[model samples]
Target: MNTAKSTLVACCQLAPKIGDLAYNRSLTERAIRSAALRGAQVVVLPELVQSGYLFADRNEALALAETRDGPTLRLWQALARELNLVVVGGFCEHLGGDDLANSAALIDAQGVRAVYRKAHLWDAEKEIFTAGSEAPPVIETVHGRIGMLICYDLEFPEWVRLPALAGADLLCAPVNWPDGPRPQTERPAEVLRVQANASVNRLFIAACDRYGHERGVGWVQGSVIVDADGYPVAGPAEQGGEQILLATLNLAEARNKRISERNDLHRDRRPHLYGMDSSLD
Candidate 1:
């Protein structure tokens, strides 16, 4: 466990409107620049950060989707190289001839590194986006080995666990969590869900989220960072403004914490006994 290396990570939590690609792009570029100026080596933005969350209808959603190698990627590549930074964010990918995929992409000092399409679609998503067939891949970078997952994927424990098992040091989640119309009491459940996920996985997690109303759709404004111990080390910006969640991510700490006695949950799991959709039961 080499506790020698550390990297600064930033999560940009901002608001963008649905179908407003130009505005969304500007928002992201500004956030990237801000993060870089703040000395963040790794900067993350919310899911569909390029094109605001358009969950209404399939046709409308697909129209806003862009290809992996499209103009959007090129722009991100240029920015990543110029800033010499790692940029992770979500987008609606246009697959052409097939249905579009809700995808997350990683861009670094080199260029577009790898992409992960959302495997688990939520509610109205099933009608607009096709479920990604490929599994998530962990890519090694200057900072550490990183993995990408879109919004709803973080809710499942195995989604984070499998990647960690494959040597993922950081899990980047680009989310567009909706804000319920109910009282503040209901929001705590969502916050606790992220904390539990981070703690159980013993992995560093960063979530960049969309805020404000888009296409009249309300969103959960807080973008947060959870440490290896499953604690909210940074965010939950409930106040009423855009902000960045900055934190020092020590890759070595993940390994040390995982092996520590404080969390035997990882070591004590019995796969044989809990096989085949056991979580469903």
Candidate 2:
């Protein structure tokens, strides 16, 4: 039997229907229970897994947006406590009145820990949601120190660096990657970026993506769990439609930043020089 240092992580790649809150909630409950049965201590679901992507309009998105105390998150909190697992998933957040946000919640047995709103809006999302201003949240859990972020946010290396610097051992990302053209025999760039982020930060990353076409749009369905070395310990799950990807990680390994015994990834960074006229991000 393995020890406590190992954390079993799972990425549930499901196809959520648009504008159907009840169905999405039920689907996530099932997925969470199933992952728990399979020994997943950290379970991740796709971005907007609670509300689905591809809103026809802001009205539809607003209709789907829910508060932190909404039913979906409430269910997750219950499941996290009952199954004794950490859940990181996404939803369309209702921010009072007419404002809405694309956000994710980090919940453990103690209940909702942190909510991260997508800081970088994508495409039509600009019109439908308000971009978040805060950085990704990192929290300590029974399993390990875990951090969270959403899709598209992964594209910025600078942003991903924040959680790593905060002493997070694992970073959970909920993404809904729209399908696009790429080399047929090669891997998707989406998966490649997850690996790059993991290796560069010396942190483990679990990215869960959704599948199926919505409003003539198909996704990469690329749910993955990457190790600190940037290699996949579980899945790329690209094109694998509706599935769960799991990997048991020794989260403690991420603490060691040594690559060649001489070079350290974090210590070597020179961000102060990256800015224009010494004032930059």
Candidate 3:
């Protein structure tokens, strides 16, 4: 694929009603269209967007889970092809009988390009979903090589680093952050973590977090789009409302991960001295 000169990425913060599949789908579709109208070539939605988070039990989760070719994803695939855009978002995945996973899908004009299962489950999620065993693969696109992670997976440095090392220019993080006590600072700790990850890897990151309360559980709503240098180009959007954060970025900048003449982010790595023996086997 030819490298795109510049891409407009949008992170959509939504408030999906719990268990409202149809309503959530409509909301997501609207958000995608809105982003496309603003010239966004890449759009990301929040984790568990179609089914919503905070399920009552495993059965409830299973009820909302859908197969890879289910209605929601099919609609997204059609939209991607129609709008000529890349869509990355999270959903409850149904892998045959009684098997479910918290997964994210990357769709483009070619349809579903990749799916990333959340490797690290958070809190009660372990009880409702199967944890993924493999790391996500980097997908080549006209805009750039895109990688994906869902919710708590973003908390793990190794998970994010794997994609960067695999030549991913941007990481699309679909998150459902629970409401937590915030410091007096403007940005939430979760947003700060994303910024740190982007700066460390020298890659752009679009973290799309949901807002509002779901089944009595509140969300922090720190959806943001950060540049390759880790500065926020869009937002730490309002804590209680649905919002879309957009940023235009030169994807090639991420490939040049050098801070100065003698410092290259990937080449300067001292993995051999980091205390892990690669030759143990």
Candidate 4:
């Protein structure tokens, strides 16, 4: 409970091959162990890491998903307990009755603590994955009060704002962004968007993105760890190879940055003005 002590978090970026659950899980476990060895209290992996993004059809995608407490989760739970580490990662979830969700799980030293289905699906996600009705949960762990977001969720400022409003000090992301096959100029904008979110919110943002080539889609490599100041501590801005970026955070400092009454975005929000935007179909 010493907010003054620094917290260490790791971003585990990978180029997970699509449809390779076993391989991806193994890779994840390895990353977790490696991060723990490096003294990270929490390790974050990219979204849908278990299954390489095979978005060819709904049936194919659903076939590869599982419940939050299914076999895959059990494995992660065991690993988390054994390593005494907290993990946040993305996965394709089978909620039941033929429904599917693009979800993120927060597993701590004890077990899977929370599951957040992506609420705002982007592009093809709208067609394949069901959007979650609930908001992002701010989870309190041995690490800190953490906010969880996945991939495109970072594109929306509101996605990060809600958790910060709920007293989150750290924001963890698990992403699988494909290379638009464009030049570098096009990619920095996306990266800057995430950094801007971190800076404006005054919260540490740890983003782990999938790298390498999969299903003919290349990735914009970089698994980044941005401080509360909205600056990357380490990792690539371009495509990341399998790697880990480690950084320490003091949430107490982040909490102080937004303390002013006048500049408090968390307290100054006008809900009446916000409902119009939320009502969009």
Candidate 5:
């Protein structure tokens, strides 16, 4: 009996219309159901996918934001129960009294397990969303220990470290990587960052990105599922349109953070020497 622990993870890279709450919800519903049909134990979607990115102004963003109990989350919760798969997707969070956040929810068969708000804001996001002060939440699911984060939050190694340190086997990031200039025939720098983060933590990472130009902005469409060794198992997508990338990951691999026999990834950490206002966490 080969009992190696593994799970099929899917990154549903699709475009969500700006300010079209109904359309976005329908888009995600299709993607989630499709992923579940394809044997995905976990499905991930793009950043701010509940509404869309590139809001015209605060008024526009506020109009699109949804509370946790809103229709979108309710639909996701229903799907999670019916399909019995984990869903990690981003949304424009309405944090009562006009405050908004770039948030992602982790849901399983039981219900909405956790909601992580984006801590690091990107360009225009600083103007519209309130940055979350809370650290990323790691929840134990039937598949494995799962952690959640949104786009720019993945850029901060310290932030990613928190979940890994807390014993998360996999990290799901919902991203909307705007198209940017890079060298010809080279991978997107954003994709490279996901690989780097996974390797450092020896944790599996699934980052789902969006496509379709939104309000004059094009996206990278670099959805990917990387293994603990930092290599792409599914995709850094072809950069065309929408795509569904899937990979089966050995969740047990993350438990052994050994690159070399003597060098353990977490055990060899020199954090105390890295200068901080520490009571030595």
Candidate 6:
């Protein structure tokens, strides 16, 4: 296996206006260019970046949704080629007919590499989008094996573990975190969850979240980049503003899931003893 020496990852936190495709595209493009100029090999943007979140209804979401070969993604493909970097971001995906899915696409110089539809829908999203059936795939790239999940998927431990078992070096999460209570000194609970997931999997996690209020909904702007040890390397950025968090990660280190000589996060799993049948009952 060809392990990456080191890869610079960036998470872009920006507020997208609801129903404003052009403005969102401009913001996304500028962020991508800026991150690329800063030597980021992989740049991740917030969920529903092009179409924005907080849609009023299913009809409104469908109006903003784009197909896989749509203009927004085409622009990303062009930028990926020009910048020679990988870009991962979320969008409202049109799945033909009346179907729409909240999806994230991984784009590189060669074009769209993989697309992951959000498997778990949250709140009003359940009313506007269809849940994706497939799990995120581990994609091979020059930098490393990349996996993806959207906002709510990160909450599921099984979802995170699947990618780790598949040998993913990095997990990109495009999120639109809703506002919630947090302690004065402690990080947001969502940020802590990503850190724990990254630490347990021994992989890097870059969560790109948006800030500000949209359509009467407030967001938690706790974008972060966590290393294999489950510590924040870059953010937990301030709320209600745009920010970019950058960090260089050793992809090779993620391949080592062993905490010590006797323990391995992956190898030590006792699936047989977990009683899957009983859990189902």
The number of clashing residue pairs in each candidate reads 1, 0, 0, 6, 0, 0
**TM-score: which candidate is best?**
5
Candidate 1 global CA lDDT score: 0.79
The residue-level lDDT of candidate 6 at 201 comes to 89
Question: In model 2, which range of ten residues has the least summed lDDT?
Answer: 272-281
Local accuracy of candidate 3 as per-residue lDDT tens digits, 1-281:
33458889999999898899999999999999999999999999999998999999999999999988999999999999999999999999998879999999999999999999999999999899999987877999989899999878888987888899899999999999987776766678898899999999999999999987777888888899899889999888847489888998888889988999999988887777876456421
Candidate 6 lDDT tens digits, 1-281: 45657899999998888898999899999999999989999999999998999888999999999987998999999999999999999999999999999999999999999999999999999998999989798899889999999999999998888888888999999999998777877778999899999998899999999986888788888899889999988988858489889999888889998999899888777765765443322
RMSD of each: 2.9, 2.3, 1.9, 3.0, 1.6, 2.4
Model 5: per-residue Cα lDDT over 40-107, one tens digit each: 99999999899999999999999989998999999999999999999999999999999999999999
The list of candidate 1 runs beyond 4 A from truth reads: 181-187, 257-264, 276-281
Query: How many residue-pair clashes does candidate 6 contain?
Result: 0
Candidate 3: TM-score? Answer: 0.96
Question: Native-vs-model 3 lDDT?
Answer: 0.90
Worst 10 residues of 5 by lDDT: 272-281
Candidate 5 has which clashing residue pairs, if any? none
- Find the candidate with the highest lDDT and give its number: 2
lDDT of 4: 0.81
RMSD of 4: 3.0
How well is each residue in 1-281 modelled by candidate 4, as lDDT tens digits? Answer: 57788888898887777777788888888888899999988889888987777578898888789898776678789888998888898889998888899998999877889999998887888888889988888998876788898888889897778787777888888887776745645546557777888887788888888877766777777678887777888664466477888888776666755546567644456666767454331
Q: What lDDT tens digits, residue by residue, belong to model 2 across residues 168-247?
A: 89999999999999989989999999999999989999999999789999999889999999999988987999999999
Q: lDDT of all the models against the reference?
A: 0.79, 0.92, 0.90, 0.81, 0.92, 0.91
TM-scores for candidates 1 onward, in order: 0.91, 0.96, 0.96, 0.91, 0.97, 0.96
Off by over 4 Å in 6: 1-4, 276-281
- lDDT of predicted model 2: 0.92
Tens-digit lDDT track of model 1 for 237-279 = 6544578889887866666444445646566567657683555
Better of 1 and 3 by lDDT: 3
List candidate 2 stretches off by more than 4 Å. Answer: 1-4, 276-281
